[model samples]
Target: MQQTVPPPLRPYIIHPYLRRTHTMIKKRIEDDILIVTLENGRDNSITAEFYHELKDIIQEANSKPSPKGIIFTGEGRFFSSGFNLSMFLSFKTPREIADFFSKTEEPVLLDLFMCSKPVIAALNGHTVAGGLILAMACDYRLATPNPKAKYGMSEIKIGLPLAIAQGEIVRFGVADDRNYRDLVYFGKMMDVNEARENRMVDEVVEESELIPRAKQLVSLWIDNPGRAFTPIKRLLRGPLADRIQKGIDELDWEDSLKCFFYDDVRKTLEFVQASLNK
Candidate 1:
């Protein structure tokens, strides 16, 4: 006699307010994992709405029970191209730009860095600029071995400086300053093997295996009791976390805003907009 097989598990939408839409960041729960997928166009570029929705989702994930870990990934070919340059170009003044970062971007990234549960980045493809920063904030990173996919910080190339909190996160995340300088100062885009070597990614696998591998990693962490894991993680990450918090607290809005109006930056923004128009 044949035995009955159990039905496969299905994911449920976890965010109460999410309306399934092409551009909305999506949240789903499968077993003990919470999956957050970036879905804001081809590049999955960060927008104001994206930041707000993501922050809400992260908060919700932390408040809920049973999910031992979170997995962050992008919808398609690009993990994320970075901050929304188009949105920045729309800002009328440097103060507005400063306010956007202080209120939205910085806080969201910091939240990820300090999340109570372990977070994993499942990089589906190319990740650049602020996208790289976001991934680095996660506890672990796994990427698809797509030769075409590039990874690096391109802020300097784009005429932007890394904010204080962002700089601290990089310093904490990357094991070597030389690699960090190569990514941030030189703006070099590296392939998967190079990224893994430089400690940007923990592992690289086929595209189809990315999510499964991320789940496997999360399961390994989740097997530990939360009471044991949470405190240890906090202790291990505490010093850097404190520095990040201090930097954010002391962030100089006026000095930070000055870069937004720099002639070179303005030209870069114009060039980006022009390219997008084409």
Candidate 2:
């Protein structure tokens, strides 16, 4: 298949809101596929800056002579440790925390889920909580078969309930009702094989073969033109998308914020922070 080479992308502007120290995302175009790597030091913990950069990059990839697909992966042993816990813990008000999620995280997940081209999350390592939500937003997910690498949502254990959008993404992505309940209710981290068995990940491959397998999957869907592909995806995913959007609209942000104020959550956050510091 002859692939279309997209025109040069407009240089992305570094948003003034982004912290100057956090240039952790890197992008490279490979024959119609955009490979985006997240290497924010050790854990690639997401922050406001990470969200802005990621949103811009994905937007860029969707522009002129749009790439056939996008592959998102992380460097080192952790794909993402989820949200930047330290920063999140610092917010003083419910509104501030609500704004952070509504303004930063929500849009990015929506973009990935509703993207015109196929999006694949190539998990090189551990993926938890918000990281799992991000992976769920993708059309397909692939993970490296490392026994040490874990994947699952741990928000319940941390005294945080799933946001409406987050919950919808998981429900829509993972088809089995039993698997969905187990993941969210228990907040258990599963190994690669277990994740695959529960349909959380499409396939598990060796670290060396992760990107290649992702590219192979992208090739299968790249043939559809954007006009056709976009609408078809909308139609196919419409019911779930509508359900998710409605839930987002009805979510009680103020009440959701109260979770962070609980003693159990604070203790859990403290524990998580201490462990990360080690």
Candidate 3:
């Protein structure tokens, strides 16, 4: 789908607060909230570098005394197409895939989900698969009213099983068991309205309102979110995080990797991999 988060009607404030760019993330502080825009090429496919940068940003925001909430948005047509299909295709061995997933991606996702400060996804475009997984970790999500934008966890269709962090975040975020099954097992990508109904996003606003609305919502719980909100959030989600960590600790990557590489899975992945080139 052709879409772009309109050139910020209000250009990002860069003078008073820091404005910085990395390989995959564009960041600035506005109204005391961190505005993080995914800036990798067209689709903002999550790469290892992207995870590192995002994890660093989360650390920096969490370390601050006043606390900084985050608003994650997107550039161009995709909030993110999820993990880069190209990167997965480049994995020559199951060990490489296991290492890439178990070591790098999981830890970063865990950090984001367990962050003390509040986080919101002000989606500027379509979010799917692992990208939506990241969004589900946020405290709240607001998506633009982009007619073509879709949202869902598509990993099942791509022949990957949800890891601990992924499964819990999705389970914790979805409204009910049926929605969970529809998104995870069925791999059905829903339009923005359907996504809201499925609890993938909390609200849908016009494209121009995404950032402003996100900021307003953050402003409400803006003060000492790390102090007040953290405990409450932990109270609600601590067990879930612990469960995910436990699963991660005990997971047999070899077995998981083996399950993901069956003949049908490989063929499907190869087909999707080829589509990326087209």
Candidate 4:
């Protein structure tokens, strides 16, 4: 008997925050799994709108039980390059830039980090900066074996310190002290082998195997009896999630503003924007 695939839950995602006619996330269900793919610009840079839609999807997934699990991937060569460099340029002043970042920090990543349905990241390519945060939020991450793919957080290079959610998630994801320092302090963009060795991702698979492998892992997690995974994960991650949100609520953004407008940092941001064009 042929199984009928469920129609897409959100063919054209719309939300009040997004004033435009389009959304960057593409959603569909296959084999009862919610597959969310980032179809943003060339590098799949994270944007305010992208975060909003992703949060809405997570909320919808948690508010029901039909999809069973979720897999987040990218459309093309890059899984996500993290924050779009040009976004910073869009703001005219340090305060404006800081405010924008603050408004976007409604703990979208934390929502993913605490998703009720098991989540997996099928990283199609480069996963850096905020991209790393998104991957780290998932229960498991499988990076594609693409030569052009790179991973890790390079925010420090441009003098951006980890915000509340970014820092806590990185801390929660890894237990080794040395590894944590290497990630936040050095902030290098690592290749696939180095990424694996440094534990940026759970495993590396070929392009064809990436989505399939994510689905397989999600099945293993969701197949357990009695839906026990949710509470168990909560038991493990709840306190940290609580702490992160509390921090967000109290965040003032002044320090981050300083980092954003530091002369050297502004120069570096320009360099990043230039690099994207090249």
Candidate 5:
């Protein structure tokens, strides 16, 4: 006999805020889990603006009376193609980049680590670089079995070190130091099987089943019903989180770092894109 998988539950209402921002990142409650959808037709880049909105939404989720969980997923086909290269190239100074990242993103990462709520990631498609880091922050990651789905800490491929905070999260998420090094250092995109084998993802299911499985997984935490889940998670994750936070505080001129300067990355990416187009 074979098993059947359930379909994803579509949120009744998808709210969009702040028309100024190109991306429409929104949060809604489904049962006990807060579903935060990263929806911008533009590759779902994580700009400082996105983090500001995320902080506001997460704070709201925390304020709710019921036990809480989070489900992070992309709006369309792409989970995220990673940082928007065009955005990366627009930085005028490293200090600006550093300041933007440290001030906006660090707090969000800390919030995810410290939040009493359990988070589940629905990897609907390819997840790259910082995007993958966002998914890894969650307590559970459910990926699609599609061969096209790739996930990795690919910052090194563009001459940047993965953010200290992101690296630390991946480290703790995988639970094995060696596998973490291979995945982070190689900066290579891994298929679903490779991701599952390396412990980058908790489980892989059909694309249509990703969200429901995520909800089911979070339900277990909601059912367990206590601080034990988040408490133990934070406890085990405390040291690494502290280390990353300290590193972020110490970073200088991070925004201006040539590693992510658009020109170089663009040139490199053009060849890759051309090859893919071939």
Candidate 6:
């Protein structure tokens, strides 16, 4: 079957955002929202370059004539698979791994949290581990009703502890505490319907309606673009964000770095590489 054309592109003609040519992010301004797409292909793993692109987008979003709101989504089958394992595995020492995690946790993340404009997520498909982190940074999340589409924070399975600070960023959007625990503790990927039942997904619709519905939802928030939304966002999230900051400041990322060198991690990488080849 022929693939559908990508959502229409808009020129950045005079935008202030500085972007690297190798970044996988795509940006377009649609109506009152700045639409940013994660285009890292089927897996859409987050690379250092992805962070650079995201930082540029947020900086531009904060510049003069900044967009009133933002819409973030993914292209193709999956939203994001989280950090690229190839890059993570490149480090030979615990120090290198610590550096990797530090670089991955960029200020752009904080920028997303503090942006005055409301950000919405059009969660197109499977979102796992750090993928959930990206989705959580947005103010709203819309997901497609695919039985195979799963969402979760699966960092623990890889011998790395959950980035609880980032995890809290996503959990706040959820309506129930039980649902939040299920996602963080068990680390199992949950289907679209399950995500909706737990309030992880704001709306669940047919795959065909995903983009249009996302646009519709963002449009609804445009009416009071500068007045109501931003303030409430600050008031509601400010405290939780402070805790996240504290958690990051105290985390022993060094331990995680050491864990990455174990034989199990190496074996896991080999299995993953072999499967990808297939």
lDDT (CA) per prediction: 0.76, 0.78, 0.78, 0.77, 0.69, 0.69
Clashes of each: 0, 0, 0, 0, 5, 0
The residue-level lDDT of candidate 1 at 260 comes to 78
User: RMSDs, each prediction?
Assistant: 8.0, 4.3, 9.5, 5.7, 8.3, 8.3
lDDT string, candidate 2, 1-278, tens digits: 33333323223333334344767778888878889888886988777777777777667656644677899999899888888777768777787777666655665666667776778999999998888888888888999879989999998878887777788888877858888998999999999989888878988788889999899888777666544555667677767766766666677777777888777888899899779878
Query: What are the clashing pairs of model 1?
Result: none
Error of 6 at 86 (Å): 0.9
Candidate 5's C-alpha runs over 4 A off are: 1-20, 253-278
Writing each residue's lDDT as its tens digit, candidate 4 over 90-208 gives 66666665555555544567777888778999999889888888888889889877777888888888878888878888776764668889988888778887877766788988889
Quality of model 5 by C-alpha lDDT: 0.69
- Report the error of model 6 at residue 203, Å: 0.4
Better of 1 and 4 by lDDT: 4
Candidate 2 clashes between residue pairs 3 or more apart in a chain or in different chains: none
Query: What is the C-alpha lDDT profile of model 5 across 50-124, one tens digit per residue?
Result: 666666655655655453678889977678766555454555666555655666566577667556567788998
**Clash tally for model 5:** 5
Cα lDDT for residue 132, candidate 5: 85
- lDDT pick, better of 1 and 5: 1
TM-scores for all predictions: 0.88, 0.88, 0.87, 0.87, 0.81, 0.83
For TM-score, candidate 1 versus 5, the one ahead is 1
For candidate 4, what is the TM-score? 0.87
Cα lDDT tens digits for candidate 1, 1-278 = 23222122212222222222435578788777989898877788876667666677667656655577899999989888887787777777766667766766677777777676778999999898888888998999999879999999888877888887687787677869877877788999999889898888998888899888899888877576433555667677767767776776687876877887888888997897567546
Q: What is the lDDT of residue 63 in candidate 4?
A: 72
Tens-place lDDT per residue, model 6, 1-278, is: 33111121122122112223567778887776788888885778777667666766766665534576788888888898887776656666776656545444534575577666668888988887778888878877899877888888776666665554566777777777787787777878888877877777888877787777777766676565344655566677878877776766677778845767888976676666456445
lDDT of 3 by residue, 1-278 (tens): 32111111111112211122448888888988889899877788777677767767777766664345888998999998888776666666777777766776776787788776779999888899989998999999999888899898888877888888888888889899888987888888899999999898999898889999998887777564235765677677778877887887789886787755677877887888678657
Cα deviation at 84, candidate 4, in Å, is: 0.8
